[model samples]
Target: MIISILVLEGPYNHEASDSAYNFIQAALAKGHAIRGIFFYDDGVYNVTRLMDPPQDDRHISRRWSELGATGIDMVVCIAAAKRRGITNEVLAPNIRISGLGQLASMIHESDRIVTFGD
Candidate 1:
């Protein structure tokens, strides 16, 4: 099954984000393809490279980076990101530093869009 996940909360002081991360791993392990992981609200901060968590804890940013490295498509809504000071780097001919359009498109194209709420 193809899955597109929408994460709407940040990682601090919550288990929801970590739960979503584990769920993604399980989905991948079950041979389900991740169509996209879209971040909205505080969740957009998950992608910020500037994140520096405690040394002993699971770094959510690094976890996400690893997920991205696995070839899963990751997206963050522009408005939400801007509000949280998260910046999406766009270094291409078509892609730009922008909004929820790509995520909405991914949702529209996917068979499912699961949401994680805080």
Candidate 2:
């Protein structure tokens, strides 16, 4: 299966980001192909390089970056990102800032679209 993910919530404050990450990992373990991950709304925060957490805590942004390094398209919505003061300079590795057109393309190319949010 070719699946794309849409995340609408931020990290730490909510469980949506963690849930999405776990879902992707499980899907990959099951041999499902992940077409992409589109971060919209507060979800854009998940790819910020400025994120810092306690040493013992999981680093959410780093996790996303590592996942993205596996060749999955990890995109942050440009409009949403700008609204939240996120720019290319602050984006984590393997992640890019793009427009809604990218999300449209992901939706069009994906066989399934799984969304995690309120």
For each candidate, the alpha-carbon lDDT, in order, equals 0.76, 0.97
Model 2 global lDDT (CA atoms, 0 to 1) = 0.97
lDDT of 2 at 9: 99
What TM-score, computed on C-alpha atoms, does each candidate reach?
0.86, 0.98
Q: Which stretches of candidate 2 lie over 4 Å from their true place?
A: none
Residues 2-100, model 1: lDDT tens digits:
999888888876677888899988998999899888878877766767667889988887788778777777777778777766665521112134568
Best by lDDT: 2
Which residue pairs collide in model 2, if any? none
